[model samples]
Target: MIVPICSCYGQTEDGILSKHEKWEFVLEDTGDVLQIAIPLAAGLTTLFKKDYKGSKQFALSYATSLVVTHSLKRIIRKERPEDRNLFDAFPSGHTTSAFSGASFIQRRYGWKYGKWAYLGAAIVGVSRMEGPDGWHDIWDVLAGAAVGIGSTYLFTTPYEKQPVQVGFYSNGNDTYILSLKYEF
Candidate 1:
């Protein structure tokens, strides 16, 4: 049946993968899942925190990254490193998706919170290049990351409540002092 035939396509000799191939598949699959998971998590975090403005910024950044990444993929018409026949490979979409969410979290929240997400995004980029398919080159991965981060940078601002202000107070008399203020 067609289903059986299609299923067989993912297998190697004897419909089984070798140890090396298994690891590669794991990396590829992880990247594939994280690409979607990262963004979805970011959006959900915004909702959970009741950050409506951050939700809008995240949406714009994510949408822009997708649009720009896909548009360049089509316009450049670059071929994949592994697959010669497939031409939509100028930018790695997986990397873009992962970075979009990571950068959004970093910009809208803080690096302390976003560092793990960024690491995940970096793994996505590496997987795109070193995984079983090796679908993209370094340039593609870098460009994807740039597009993702750049879009977020353009639209996202630091969480409004996180600023610390240093104030200098002075009176007509010799009353001068430095005060640090933080709003919780």
Candidate 2:
């Protein structure tokens, strides 16, 4: 993705500096959508499935993350790359929201759901760095990822804590994989 976009934009450097696919912008937009949609989806799904506790947990996670992300944005006051603003760029809110939803799905369900969700979240973060106007640095994306993952972890710990996990997956096409995870 970066190869083609960088080549076209004349940015052959290895560092983040902007210009990628328009679809990358769409990915960020999807992150924006997920911020709202994930909580709604989780809450409603749990409610309809008669899992009241899950619904409450999901709501709590979303609210706390939203508050924390915004508060940090105000406190940090970092500047954007394109001079769009003098502050509010320490962390990418879109990335935070995307990771929040992705992490929530992973923590609540399993890696099967998490793998794809996290990929989407990562794409959202990358999209933020794909254009100058987007104006999100690598650190911004990292902080957002951390915040999103931390919030979800904090909220989901009580409900579903996986101390350790070992699993395997098969694509039914002679492709098989083994995985392991340990959570403190």
Candidate 3:
């Protein structure tokens, strides 16, 4: 239902492909490689910080979500708008992967990094729209976000203690600092 509506409303082939060509400069295979690698690194960092279970949970969730989405896409085999390929576009896999990473970061670091994390996810959504092999509408991106965030939160262990006082401060010398005081 949602997929069909999105597909109907999305930009035509020329519009979408034009954007794709522009984004190709920055969002090519190398970019995807970085996207995949960075999140795994962040998850490992969480593990080293003694959140071993949480890290493992995030890693597994991310991987599982990607696999499931990709498999479903393969089975559906919906054709891309440009006819460049045949894979389901009901949900954007790259967007899902981006959201999964962002969710992991938010869970491990709290809301301090939330803005940037979500910004990255948004970029992925846009990239998906721009790419030849991409999703057509907001629904697809939303669906991907749901799967990514849901999997991460459901699989991770709850924080032992929430941060009591989390805030930021700026000095007169144009310097800023963030402080987190936790109570366990």
- Best-fitting candidate, scored by lDDT: 1
lDDT of model 1, residue 30:
93
Residue lDDT tens for model 3, 81-163: 55656557756687788788878777767767756776777777776665544444676677777777877777765445445
Off by over 4 Å in 3: 1-24, 27-34, 131-137, 161-184
Clashes of each: 0, 0, 0
lDDT of 1 by residue, 119-173 (tens): 9999999999987668899999999999999999999988775468898988979
Assess every candidate by TM-score.
0.78, 0.67, 0.63
Regions more than 4 Å wrong, model 2: 1-28, 157-184
Consecutive 10-residue window with the lowest summed lDDT within model 2: 5-14
Candidate 2's residue-wise lDDT over 93-154, tens digit each? Answer: 88788788778777877787678778878877886787435658999999988888888888
By TM-score, the better pick of 1 and 3 is 1
Q: Which residue pairs collide in model 1, if any? A: none
Q: Model 2 has how many clashing residue pairs?
A: 0
lDDT preference between candidates 1 and 3, better one: 1
Q: How accurate is candidate 3 locally (lDDT)?
A: 0.67
Alpha-carbon error at 107 in model 3, in Å? 2.7
